[model samples]
Target chain A: MNLMMLLEMASQGFADRGAVQNGDQRLSYAELFSAAGGAAGIAREAGVEKLAVLDVSSLAVPVGLFGAAWSGKPFVPLNYRLTDAELESLASQIAPSLLVTSRDRVGSLSKLPDTQVMERDEFLERALGAETPTADWSMDPDEIAILLFTSGTTGAPKAAVLRHKHLVAYILGSVEFAGAAEEDAALVSVPPYHVAGMSAICSSVYAGRRIVQLPSFDPDEWLRLAREEGVSNAFVVPTMLSRIVDSIGEGAEAGLPGLRAVSYGGGKMPLPVIARAMRAFPDTNFTNAYGLTETSSTITVLGPEDHRVAAASDDEAVRRRLTSVGQALPTVEIEIRDENGAKLGPGERGEIYVRGEQVSGEYLGRGSSVLNDGFFPTRDAGSMDAEGYLFIEGRADDVIVRGGENMSPGEIEDVLLEHPAVADAGVVGVPDEEWGEAVAAAVVLKDGQDASSQDLQVWVRERLRSSRTPQRIEFRGELPYNETGKLLRRVLRTELAS
Target chain B: MGQLKAGSRLRSAVCDTEVMVVAAPAAEVELSCGGAAMLEIAAARSGDGAPAPDAAEGTQLGKRYVNEAGDLEILCTKPGQGSLGVAGALLTVKEAKPLPASD
Candidate 1:
């Protein structure tokens, strides 16, 4: 039941296979197992309530994660990008913890009370050098495995709790044990604090896939590593992919022939970006994975076949699926529900609700948010088509209500993106005296291309109803996006409203 | 015999095979391995005897076995020289339909 069990099985199944790699440093399954045991011994001797990592992806990540599980403590990864004050506030929340961070951050982070700080190199040295403890991890499925802080783009971050059972069910249901080829390697560039990063480590371990870590994301460096390491699989946020596509240049080969599959999520991907990416990596299979931190990673995936079919089809409905998130996972059931909690039929816009063994909608202090029927309200606005394809509009709170009519920003933004000159777009509801609210848009044009605001408005009016057209359109150099590729819609709303 | 529930781990009494229940019918059913009743993972082993010749089909690690009715399924956690069965009928390996790797 413990996370250690997955590692144990992998170590036993393939003792000599490389489990993780960072630069030139590599660790086999057996080596990682003993190191985790060694790190667990340190956590136990330190008597911390939890083990926290405050650095980017590195060798210490897996050791810290599995070590925490072996010691029967929750593992917490803090955002290294946070400011000192913000970092201190979060560090204080998880007091009496073993904090692992870089050498430069040790002095400042060590000031917290009831905390023991160790640099990453020292931590790894001690973990690898210490005596290994006999496998004594508890098999309690209900034990807290990880405490992840939500990105909280709209408000303060809250800790989302993931139990061992929730994660194990997710892995066992989605992945086949030892199903990977002997030479398969997965490239992971997401920070350690993100849910995708943690799940990548766990899934790669159980699948017997070698993990290649990128300390920080750079398009040239990513391309270099993929070429040098023979990486066959990878995961990226929309921003990273967009940059990689741009870096590859137009009509030029990406030069990464070894890559077989690439999955992107964490934000809504613009249609143009994905279409261009497909052309850049002609042989790569693209998957759009959609999930939240509370869902333990991806709940729905647009598979490789769907991508190929959608890209080649002339039918508008079929081609549009390239922008959809695809169908729900076989292990999960997805429903679109109206505000009254009643289920909506196909093509009816509503909030997304999910029911599955992997859903843990509970926060640290707030009890389970799962309904009596075992469904978790995802608070994401989306619609399901007749064929079970799910199209995510945006966050439910971002929906615009203009003159008593609810409108999705995603729908309007998609129409705008179809315009040849438009490169990116964001739609928001601005306060109006007569209608109570009016549709407003901010757009970025393609390089060296020009389009007037009135012309863009006409483009939307021609495709969709006049009521859905943007009343106010502002042209900008570029739209704002967070580090993880999520659009800062709240900021746009504020600027446009004023 | 007791009704098998998901997450319950069982081990063969006469061999090294161990399995965890993934799905089971509501009703209690006889579960056996190597022509002998299975024991709970924590329960004491009956003896160190070998599997009966007729039942020694062997089990592989990480493979799932299911009964004919499809109402019972178990995941082999440890490989051993014994085939799982229900009422003298041997179980077959369940083909897995793997979901696409996301993240």
Candidate 2:
């Protein structure tokens, strides 16, 4: 089904409820529906093939999202954080398109070939004024709904194509229609470019939630909005959560007592950070969601109940699950396979392969990456426990191979992070003539705490084997992480090469 | 009266009910609504049959009706006075289990 169908249902399900709020601006479900239609009319009139958004989060985001769907055009949200050259390169890919962007870029972007540039403010005003068209959106399930450019942590970005069916399946399998309470408001701090950001719109609409937009994330502002709006739900990347936890500091009070649930993903959640967050928000249910852009949104989720159980359990295996990404969703099937494509049993580490309706293994320029058997190799190294809990062990290339021995950087990084002085750590394989590669680590020490290279090495050697210990170590003020909290291991590899 | 794949749209000839197949069984099954055969989207609705006894229950918009084996899932996109049935048996509305909101 079309994404517009979700909006259509929401408008009918709860017409008077607030669908979106940004700053002083607000739109009811009915208004958002009509606004989307207005945007669609503009898109249709422009004769554009795609709709692109190059601005921070706002009412314009949802309006543009459903508008693109209503007009049967792919919605492409470019990373606004990119530089002029970078933005121009991406914008050129979807030429002959309507680019809704911030006011400052309109003049420069209008020069791009075959591109129609509309300032975000002007677009909003026009869309608000335009009469909604009468025609309904196309129902072709194979129609492209979203085109997300991958973060390209490894290399150049590739456009990941998500069809209407994949996204609809994800929403249908995961969300319950009109499940959210009338007073429940979701604080959306994530950017519109990310897959999670897009799914947040669809799922919230289907669930009839009042979405409160945060254009850009600020810890104090986030907390203030949560309190002011009585936000019951929120989704933040790991780094955002860490900062929010740090901002709250050590406290007994339930921060934002109205927050009923908090889900964090998009990067590894450090043990210390999540532990502190759980304590800070004692009543909030913590969900650890893990998925890739290729997978509509979340393929597996560590539910809130799992967090409480794992934390309070006496069993070591059960307690370790607090760090795991949890089990696969009912509609998803996950398997860990070796390099030869052989499926591995529980406790055997291998690459993650998944198959389900939500798995969109197709890319824009590149053909489908899905295997003949329908499983998409995730390129993520991980393992599953007997109980089906999945543990993500960094990306496949992130695995350190020293002298042909496969080692997980996450395993070594865990031991180093356990050191009381270590605040952050990244382990990589540095080139070594004798062993082909050797273990090297970059660590950030907590303020007011000190630990020598040898001290931390011994700590890892004691916990793990000597071979797993870092051969070289360097201390830094902090590790490099993207806005989304993924550690730039490629950057670490280059820095440690010297 | 044949294989129904997910994403296929169907409509009832006797009512305004339109549904998209969310899931379908591997074996052949006759999928019907309001005791009349469900036709493809392109087929014109005849509106000839009334709601049959023992299957007069109406279909709600956005509700998913599934067979007993839990394989065939039909999501009603339009509310109508037709009850969805499969293989001469009535389909029940599947309970929606709300998952924790995760982006």
Candidate 3:
């Protein structure tokens, strides 16, 4: 089924139920559907064939979102945080017909055509006041629905084109994985531009679950909301999770009475941090999810069950399982391939590849399509266990070349995380003419815990080989990371450079 | 002052609907202020000092300042920063709704 069916089902199942909610504005399924219908009419009047959304994280954004979808045009949401040059590049690429935004935020764009600009209030006014569209708006399964650009944190962003089927698979698969029910309540804070944020919204809606929306990520407020709203499910980066765990100290149980599960991603969750979370709230099912903007939210998820089982058993088996990203999602097909594109056997280290309805075939820009025999090369170095569980080694771009040996930041970072005092860790290769590249680490100590740079260095050296151990360690309050929680190793490298 | 328009042609790429009044300086300003503070922009209406035609509907100018963070539709008015005694008006538009679902 397509995304339209999801909306139609929600409209039919829970017409009077609170469908979309913000602070003062809450719209029921019927109201939202009708409002979007009204927006579809406005889009038609504006002659918008391919609508480009400028601002997404707004209350009115959903209206434009549905309206554009109903008009059967792929909705491209640009990253509002990109540089002007980056934005111009993206704008040039899309060459959209209409620019959709709010009246109050209309003065910002540096460059654009003299295209019709639909402000939020004006669009809503016209949508609510005007007649709904009469055109028979429809979409095929293969038709692109939403186009999301990469974070571009490393370099120029590549747009990932998500079709209706991909979104459907993501929502359905996530809902099944979470085992969410109508009684479940989700607290969503991730940005809508990201796949995680989008999937969270869809899964909650499809499951007929209530969602408590947070405009942004705030540690204290997030915990407060979880406790106050009786929030059952939520998504957070590992860093955010660590902050929440710290806020809720040892003695007093942080009043998360209703919170049953919390999904953590954007980076690896250190074993100690996972243990801390487990100790603090044994009741909360903390899940580890792994995905990029390229493949919806998560193609693989390590559920709470795995965490408990792994933590309970002291054997390497559990730690090894926990280290990996766990088995692929039921809907996704996973493969491990060598440099030459030949598939590797189980228990071999190679590039992780995913092929499924959830996987996109081509990027929107200069990059080639992933339709190489229908597998998207994740560019992440990984290995599959004999049991078929996937373990991410590191990103292909993140691999550091030493004199002759290759070093993966993931390997060093994982080792550093083993230290009890280390809360979060990131390893990057620093330029060194002698060795060509040297491994360096940036680590954040646990709250109220102190570990010097030498202490961390010795700690890593003890566990790993002399060559694999980080040559230098930098102590910091926290490592720089993107909104998704992925460590910005390049930042650490820049710091070392300076 | 010349009667030139203050607002430029806004593309979706440059705008954020959550935070109503956007003042993107030609250069990046190092904002030292943390947390949410009342942001005041010397906002000039499009084309002329007069607000948009829709803004004249007895709609409070404050309602024009939509804080996407709290999703609060407040009545924002032009006031001196000294009056508020706030350091800077750096509104953080962090998270937003999910991208639109397709077909």
TM-score of chain A of each: 0.99, 0.99, 0.91
lDDT of 2 at A205: 94
Deviating ranges (above 4 Å) for candidate 1: B44-47
Per-residue C-alpha lDDT of model 3 across residues A5-90, encoded as one tens digit per residue = 45555666566766666666676766767777787777677775666666645556566666767777777766656655666677
Off by over 4 Å in 2: A252-254, B1-3, B14-16, B26-30, B39-50
Q: Which ten residues in a row have the lowest lDDT in candidate 1 chain A?
A: A87-96
**Each prediction's whole-model lDDT (CA):** 0.91, 0.90, 0.64
CAPRI quality level assigned to candidate 3 from its DockQ score: incorrect
DockQ rank order: 2, 1, 3
lDDT per residue, candidate 2, A1-498, as tens digits? Answer: 788878887887799999999999999999999999999999999999999999999788999999999999999999988887787778777878999999888887788778898989888888888888874789889999999998888897789999999999999999987889999999999999999999999999989999999999998889999999999999999899988988887664446788999999999999999999999998899999999999998999999999999999999999999999999998899999999999999999999999998999898978889998989999999999999999999998788888889999999998898899998999999999998899999999998999999999999999998889999999998899988899999999999998
Q: Chain A TM-score of model 2 versus the true structure?
A: 0.99
Give each prediction's DockQ, rounded to 2 decimals: 0.64, 0.65, 0.01
Top TM-score prediction, candidate number: 1
lDDT of 1 at A29: 96
Give every prediction's interface RMSD.
1.2, 1.3, 16.1
Q: Retained native contacts per candidate, as fractions?
A: 0.46, 0.60, 0.00
lDDT of 3 by residue, B1-103 (tens): 1111111111111111111222223333322111222222333223213322322222111122323343322212211111110123333222222221110
lDDT of 1 by residue, A1-498 (tens): 778878988898898999999998999999999999989998999989999999999999999999999999999999998888887777777788999999999999888788899899998999999888988888778899999998877998788999988888888888888988999999999998999999999999999999999999999999999999999999999999989999999877897878999999999999989998998999998999999889888999999999999999999999989999999999899999999999999999999999898899989888889999999999999999999999999999989998999999999999999999999999999999988889999999999999999999899999999999999999898887878888999899999999
Candidate 3's C-alpha runs over 4 A off are: A83-85, A102-104, A172-180, A250-252, A345-347, A447-452, B1-103
